[model samples]
Target: MDRRLPVAVSFMAATIVAVLALPLELQLAVLITTPSAILWMGRTTVQHARAKEDNLRRISEIEQTINEIAGEELLLFQSRHPNRAETVGGRTGMSAVFATTLNSLLMLLVCVALFGGKHGLTAQILYFVFITAIALDLIMGAVQLNRYVYRRPPMILLEK
Candidate 1:
């Protein structure tokens, strides 16, 4: 649902612009679809940003918890279970990757939609910038998740 909303809006915007940008002088279509595109892009970008922030926050809390656990407890866990790290890695990495991929694909869709189907090269630049923001947000989340999930020597370590 979250992912689909942005895609649908982008497609609709692209269709409107393509259809209206004709020499038919449909300025009304521009007035209508331009703001609609902006609104959709604005709302989707905010939603994506918030979701990315939330996921990063979770990863940070888990990392902090790991940092707090120390000494024999950490050692025992590490020794007895080698794959625990991978499980944590999968959990954090997967979430980040999922969000990133979703955002990236959406951005790509918007880009091509604008260029290939919509108002030529003019609006393409703006859409690119708009969609790029969401991509960056996704990247931010992935970086945070990686830092948390792949800390060297593990965030939680045994005190010698």
Candidate 2:
């Protein structure tokens, strides 16, 4: 897991709380800023990945040179890790499912809150329901984050 993920999640939670407390115009500004920040972070991640790939390519070239000088075959990292792609697809699929479920639940909650008002729901009750939904979402997010941050690699054993 990336070290920055936790910090980003915390930042998002803070932004949501701040938005909830701010005026309507300020909340709109903050909402805009949040996506901009996310885009900047994503661009940074892409640049970092590209730089790492370039460094790996250079290392591979040097390895090829050394192999040519010594008249021996040297295996590249990719050949040694041929199974890397196989392990990632399952996790990605599961994550997609999880995200979709969470989003559906949020939509259901919003619909309930909106429709309840038509049936003479009190303002406090609507507010409570909305806040409950947000709280549930945040708690679930924190739990998922904790699982990812503390997850151990497969076959890693701890001593008692």
Candidate 3:
């Protein structure tokens, strides 16, 4: 099981509780900030992915040079580190999907809050559901950011 899944789920739960418990102004702040943060994180993730790819390419080139000089298949970088050599799919699409879903949900809730006046049980329930959705999005964005920012480089790269 991917460890990040559990961490993301727990983070979502905590965010839901925290946001729901916050004052109206703070909740609004969160709603305002989340989209911007998602956009920034998406950009950062792309840049990080590009950098990682470039670094891997450089490592492969260096290994090839070393092998040529030694006149044999000495540094089998890919064979030795298959996991690191494997390419991961881009995450920009996922980020866009999450952002779009969160925005639509937020807009729906805003409409309800603005036009559907009179806070009854149903309205309250809708509000809760929307808040939960927003919290989930926030946690997912955090998870994505964490995945790129904190990943450990391949051990071979660290060997100088």
User: Sorted on TM-score, highest at the top, how do the candidates line up?
Assistant: 2, 3, 1
- How many residue pairs clash in all the candidates, one count each? 0, 0, 0
lDDT: worst 10-residue window of model 3 = 1-10
Question: Residue 109's C-alpha lDDT in candidate 2?
Answer: 44
- Better candidate by TM-score, 1 or 2: 2
lDDT of each model, Cα atoms only?
A: 0.49, 0.45, 0.50
lDDT, candidate 1, 1-160, per-residue tens? 2465556556655655575356534643443345445445444444454455455445555555665675223323333444444433334334435544564555445544534424556665665675566556555654554454332333576899
In candidate 1, how many clashes are counted?
0
Instruction: Name the TM-score of candidate 2.
Output: 0.46
| Candidate 3 similarity to native, TM-score | 0.44
Superposed Cα RMSD, model 1: 9.3
Model 2 poorest ten-residue lDDT run: 144-153
Best by lDDT: 3
Candidate 3: list runs displaced more than 4 Å: 1-13, 79-160
